[model samples]
Target: MDTSTGPDTVIVGAGVAGLTAAWNLHKAGQAVTVVDPEPGMGASRAAAGMIAAVSEVMYQHTTMRTLMTTSAAMYPPLVAELTDLLGHDVGFRDTPTLDISAHPGDRDYFSALAEVQRAAGMTVERITTRQARSLEPALSPTISGAFLVSGDHQINPRRLVPSLIEALETSAAAGGPPFILLRRRAVEVLRAGEDATGAVTGVRLDDGTVITAGTTLLCPGVSLATVGGLPEADCVKLRPVHGDILRARLRPGRPPLLERTVRGMVDGRPVYLVPRTDGEIVIGATEREDSFDGVVLEGAYQLLRDAQVLVPGAADLELTEILARARPGTPDDLPYIGRLDGVDGLVISTGYSRHGILLAPLGGHLAAGLVLGTAPTEQDAGILAATDPRRTADPAVVDSASRDPSNGHRTPRERTAP
Candidate 1:
């Protein structure tokens, strides 16, 4: 844990967010250290990597959709940058997404939503089910309506993770080093001062070694709560929402199983199927709230049953792999990012629900810009303002009261545990 070169910034978790932040920090001439228990096996690996903003829009809110659309647009440039940095193609593909409906009610709802999105200046085109099937022969004839969103696309999240890792490794390989990828667990944040209210100095490892830094970035997916600095209520409130998906190996003579990211409402539930250039058909996602472990459940099996109604041939295909991973979801289905007040130098960028992969570039850029002294651009500023940790701060606590609860409040530490 003792190194001659002290890190300017310490980033926790090697998921997309952490890696992206490390990349930005390194580019900005800041000495960064990225610490994570696992490299490529976090939530980023479990993501389908569908960058569908319009197709995946919420029924009520457009804020997330707006952020997603902007992030989706930024992916091409980001992917190009990563590809150039990594010296390899990371499977950044520009493929439109289709949101189709099997039932009349779902089709009607989609038709209305399409109009709403179009009126809002989004590029959405309505197509008949037959026309949808014409674009991709695997689509079920039972599909009543579909909307083609031209701005949406997909990338290989699995490939992106390793590619970023390689880029980091390459930068390390060269003598010009900024961050060291410490493949170890971060047990807790070390707080300085009498009230334990000063800036986060570093993290303690399970092996009893301490690595200190000026700034600590917590990008650990579901494990963000395990860090000791955060309030027990805030920490314990963060739970995992498990999603199970199936990757089908393609056979010869079968033209792609899915042309683009095909999302549909089957039995009043949402299902998305993404096709990769390597002839892999990815059919996803059963969102179950109660599951903590990453074991595939019966609900995931039922997902396939529902998906086959949209694409009947899916059942006939060989199941390459069944992926079950837990997504870090906040109660309100939004991400928690930005600097916390109590802990001076600790920043969190977790609880990204399901759009973590699609939103990585912008999220990383904003988080990195914040950690460094560099002023964020107007775009980054807007996003950072929305996700600022101060938003989660208790408004009742004023000035010095907000800095540290342990000294201000006489409540025993035992009463604070959830």
Candidate 2:
């Protein structure tokens, strides 16, 4: 096998988390090489990209609340920097999110959740259905109740991913540390020694070529377990949580279907409609753990049916695409981000589950800090502790329902849409 060495860091995935970390490390003058068979086509491409901090709150995941809110606060500056560098918009919207319920039970569910949100210092305002319809005339007048989260926003991952790749390319062209993209799957992680105590050297690609670097950051999402040479693989305990997402477009000259994102609980199932600056509306999603990886017909039907309940205009929008991808979920729903216990020169940032897009900035920041030996702030220190790779490894404490803590009644296949 051919071996080469020069890159300071090797990132094993090109999704939002890996790309964001790559960008941060490149800006810090680190020679970064990103490895992925297809860049930005994994969960990042399938995400609806709702940066909802307040609206995404759960009952007991307080650490997630802190991480989500902190990351949401970081988006404006990140988007502005990317726009300045690329000289164009990256599809970030400051539009507020509207939370609505289609049934009395749904309303009660959210009311209790809203109380929890307020207790956590989040902004959730109870608004009348009439007021919600006033904000977006397309809203169904029959909605049971509504709440507005002004701090919640969105960014189109489809646009943001390409922007990040372009920024990385521009940095490479500017003659700093070279940015390399390897369109190949990493089959094995190379290490300095044979035992678990050894430091990570780099990775061996499927093509029989090994690329060595000082640090290796694994952001392979759900495929983390498949990669070899990791002592902490079992301890990470990443499971594939699949979700079905749909995309639709407004008819010609139809005006916008809705100005802001609308999340609704229809018959106890959660769904959301996220609008783009363009005339496209993203509707999704269904969380499932079945063996089938493709889009489920029932999930699509449920999303479309519930979408129409929130906005009748949704019935007229032409369906554009339906996609399904598996997100890496942890036992406790919090992501695993930090160095491995006995492995040196290796860092992992995966298991983001449904909030990958919302958590990318924080994940990237934390992963880059770990690589550069930069000390995290006191707040970040606590967050790091919460996301430790070895925290929830014990099988006795693993609970599938831990993914959604707001409602214990929710099945393993149901998740609150952010």
Candidate 3:
């Protein structure tokens, strides 16, 4: 098989991450082939597209919060580019978020979180309950307090994915772009030579066709565990964080339930209501770590109850869809977007967890640049280092993915003389 005559790059996974990377690389004149079962599908299919760099912050993830903010910064330009190219509105909503609370205790906790977000240089303003209600009249009227993060925005992944898929197809048809879509699962990464630890050559398709490439990017999200020819044992521990999301329809002649994305705490659990321009509200996401359990009635009930605690109108809205999918995750909540230590021609760009939509632009572009042998912008490099695939494991003095010193990666073997 003449591998070089094949696509310059073969991205395994046609999710948003893979599609975005393929688009970016093809724009740079690289012949990119994306391998997957169905295009524009994955954990992202159910995502609400909250680019909540500020509102999604946690006590332990301050560093990641900032990088998320950076990733959030990339959306406008990228979406504009896609919109112009595809001649479709991609549904990018640049609006503020109302972080509200149903009770006094939740309000206090939210107050502390606002201060933490402000300390991180995020724009946050505390608004009285009346002020919040005045901004969006859909409040439950029992809402105690609210904080507005004006910078946190959202896009319709439902819209974004289709537009991206169409854009890729259109770009390819327009003649200059070499984006080929392959409908198949990649079973294994093909190594270039007989050496067990040699650089990755390409991927072997499930249909037995071999498409060699200059580089192979594993953007398969949660299915990373199932792919062969990669040392999963040494790679970052990827787990499935299942989320159950609900979709509801806002009745006609009624005011919108959410003028902006409403993120609130109800009974100490977070619930978000994101209203689409199409009059459908996305109520999400009960997260259960490492459990791929199907949608539990209890989860749906909780989502409904929590959502009602904020708006009180969800009780009357019609149910649209109940979605359950496992978002790929890592223990440290950081994605691996760089080369694996010394493994040549390979990159792992998954473990996006819940931040897949928010981090798609950053991860896609960074992985594309690395594939092209280009470096990240100075700021992105710092964050990428923290999420580096070759991160040294706990007290091991060697990166988990770099255990094989023979893979052109320098491991701990040099502790002694040759």
Candidate 4:
């Protein structure tokens, strides 16, 4: 398979990150081609598309908070562009989110959090448990405290993915765009040198075909461990955090399960429940760092169990599907996004952890800007530097033993192995 003449950019992984990059680059007049075996099947389709910034911010993730908030601010325009191009709505809605406290004793903590967020100029209102239940009637009356974040919003990622693919194909067919979607899995980065300094010319798919492109962006999501040519240490360290998400079809006259994308802290762990415009309530995710990729875990069931505990009506809803998705997580929970140190023409865009959906648009925009040498904003520049692969001590390191293709869901066995 000869892939001699390459497109302007070849993106690996068709998840939200790769799609967003291709879209932004195409809009910027750059030829782009995207490759992924799963395409719409991977993590992108499994995302809950919650654009909750201030409400979801963990104390240690200030940088992520900045990027998430900034990118979230761009949602209206971005959603409008895609919706117009697709000639349909992607279920984007700006309903305020309620961060409810499941335990009565945690009211003070929730109150403090709300106070801090409000003082930071975020649009969150401290609400009583009654107000919280009023906003989301399905919520359990057991809620003790809640904070309403007016800026938090949500979109159906399932709908958004198809819409994006449609827009990408449309642009390509019109002959004004060079975005191509190749449904194949990338096995390794094609390089000339044995060292990381060797420039990545393209990629070799699982099949015999070799795609040689000028630039390659790694957006393989949790599949990052499967890619060759990356440092072995990095792969070993790259953990797949599993999230169990459940989808439920709304009953007639049930009212909205959530006015906005709602998140709750139960037992000091975070869980989010998002309601889509199409009357599907998405409740997810238990965060466990495991290798259970592409499989549903019991934790997902527990998510619903816990969700019902927080929102009593959840027990009455019909569950349509359960998704066990892997989020590429790091020790610090920050994404390793930036240009690889020694590999030229190869950029790392994976490792977004749980924020992949919310971070997609801005990550694509800034990455494309970096590649084109266009002027980036102050914040963009800082993020690029922080996520650079060069910051890692060694770039060419590879560990075949560390690659676990087993269920990417975290398991008790693997948990104690490392």
Candidate 5:
């Protein structure tokens, strides 16, 4: 909260989104500071860290595919840089992803998804159940269909997060950007201008401390979407899409269950298995929109059942961790990642849905560009339009007015929230 050591930018969340932005800005010679109640402990901590730009095409939108592809492509350089900075590997694996389905409905759905991916310029090849099992002998004998995608990869956030933190802290300690993390919640965004919404002056912490910055990037993930007093808090509607994930360790002497990331759909639900190098595997993610409390029960059971149905060896592994966290989901399935309508010096970079892990690097880069007043390239402009925070604020096709605090800017609506 001290202005003497004030940062040029104050990032509200220290998750992957915020961290990457801070790192990029610091590298660009900008003094940055990130604040969070609990850093590295958000949905990023619970994520499976899949960078499947092509294989996990959930929608048939060009913008989504473009963003995913660009984001996934930034990982190699990003990982290498982070590894060197922290003197440790960030756990990046350039493994192929196997898509399989045992049921008729799932097979049909995967087939349709492949078509969409192909239309989006993804290289996909259809394979028989025999070939699928040949790649991974552990695959269930009942698989009816499969697709092999070559462009997808994975990372371990468990390793990436710490490396990122240490790098930033080390830079700050050596008199770089003075980048620091405030272990406090951001209660509100301080505003200035005759209308009191012209420029964001700083952030008021929950502990009654005011940390002023030239600009503020709000990346507080999904859990803080409903928090009051922040600009556009209401405009960016977020639903906590809770995911129940299971981490298991194979007993000693057992070979790897699967070589690559295996995604499957049983019935109408989707599931995936991500293998790690330490003889551990991550089986995820049962999606539920009903509750934020991560109680392990039906969803966890279903993930295990479905994963076992895909890979029989899943049943024999020792379950290590059952993680349940809600992803900040937008109604339109796109993130809010640009400046506010009338609120200068404030940017929104949350609502990533399930692609937070993959999009972190790009999100941070774009956000820093916005703060530095750099002109976005032709492609970046389109992405900004798709994720504009003002889209859901007012129904008018054009911005008739600046984002006024009096008009409940604190409660901007998600495009379509029930």
Candidate 6:
């Protein structure tokens, strides 16, 4: 590792949230050094990449709804800026999303969910199955209900991560404060005073290299508690909520199966199909808080079986990949994205869970603003408060459960819309 020591900020993870924050800081003329063993190979790579603010709303997550919608609105400008800088598309698609239900029970569930979405000021319109089929001819005719959410969109996280890396590298090459990506695991965060009053000086890598900076941002995802030298790390309460996702490509000469993203409720379980321009469709995901780190047979079978029910053409597609990754889940299902208490120059920006891709821009902006000493607007201030890392709560009260001793994994947790 280079012994240089003037990076304004040091980021510990290079996932979407970390990379996005690095890009924002770099664009603002701040030198950034990102430390990660493998950048973008974590949960960000496995995400289905749906910008589903409108379709992902739940019954009681009002704070999450506000964060999602706000971040959804920020995507266009961020994409445009990234495209202008890179001189190419980063795989952001403004296509609408269709919410459909297969069974009568599923229809009833969505009908109630629509009320919650509407109450949060989201645009959702009920459409007949005929109308849905008219828009997407390949949809199964047996679908009992449909709703059009034109506000929801999709992006390719695979592309977004590379673009951010390229932008950061380009900036570094342009002769300013250097942007460094240290290919090493951060072992500890170096602090300058007592545990209760210390300020973050930099991070100590696994090999004992210290990269000093003015501020240190922790985005280590599920490994937050394992990072040494942070006294309050365990208090953040992060758990691994694993999910299995799949990718399939349309066979040659086959027309596109879906024009946009299609999310559905099949037998009361949520599943989604997101289409890309290059004849690929992403199907996902089965959420479980299990200890199994690899793709499960039952989870993969369920995704494939349920996807075909919504779009029967899914059965004909060629299965290309199957992956399993754990999202960093919080007790309340909201991310921790603010300054750490009693630690100066240290920002905590992990625990995004399933919404990491959807909330990247907002998380990046807030994290960078915190480093730059920029005051958030009134609207953003409320979101910052809701996501404050120091907020006190009992982690055991949530819907998640401990790992089962009989089985290798825990019980299936409640599923949320993708």
Best by TM-score: 2
- Candidate 3 residue lDDT tens string, 168-205: 78888888657778888889888766675688889888
Better of 1 and 4 by lDDT: 1
lDDT string, candidate 6, 1-418, tens digits: 5354769999999999999999989989899999999999999989989999888776556677788889988999999988988899999999899999999988988888889788877789999999999999999999999999999999999999999999889878978567999889998888886643488889889877888999999998998876788886666888899999999999999888899799998998889999999988999999888878999999999999999999998999999999999899876677888876678889989999999999999999998988888889998898888788876344542333232221111123235554
lDDT of 4 by residue, 199-301 (tens): 8888888776787877888888777878887663263246677867788877877766666666876765566778777678888766665576655556776
For model 1, the local distance difference test gives 0.74
C-alpha lDDT of candidate 2 relative to the true structure: 0.88
Candidate 2 local lDDT, 1-418, one digit each (tens): 6878669999999999999999999989999999999999999999999999888887666677888999988899889899998899998999999999998989988899899899998889999999999999999889999999999999999999989999999879978779999999999898776554478889999988889999999999999977998866678888889999999998987888899999899888899999998899999999888857899999999999999987898999999999999999877788989977778889999999989999999999999999999989998998998888877666654553354453122334335533
TM-score of each: 0.88, 0.95, 0.91, 0.87, 0.90, 0.93
The TM-score of candidate 2 is: 0.95
* CA lDDT for candidate 6: 0.86
Q: CA RMSD for every model?
A: 7.3, 2.5, 7.3, 5.8, 5.5, 4.4
- Best-fitting candidate, scored by lDDT: 2
Error of 2 at 14 (Å): 0.3
- Tens digits of per-residue lDDT, candidate 1, 1-418, equal 5433358888889989898888878877778888887886878888888887776654444456666777777788878887887778897889788887878977866777777677667889887777888998898887888888878888888898888877777776775456688888888887888876677888887666687888888898888767775562263235687888888867777666787788877656677788888888788887767775765568677668877888888877778888788888754455667776556777788877678898888778878877875687786677666566565455443234324432211122211110
Residue 18 displacement (Å), model 3 = 1.1
- Give the CA lDDT, 0 to 100, for residue 199 in model 3: 89
Residue pairs in candidate 5 whose N, alpha carbon or C atoms collide under 3 angstroms: 234-410, 234-411, 234-412, 235-411, 235-412
lDDT tens readout by residue for model 5, 53-121: 887665435566778899998999999887777776778888999988878877887788788778767
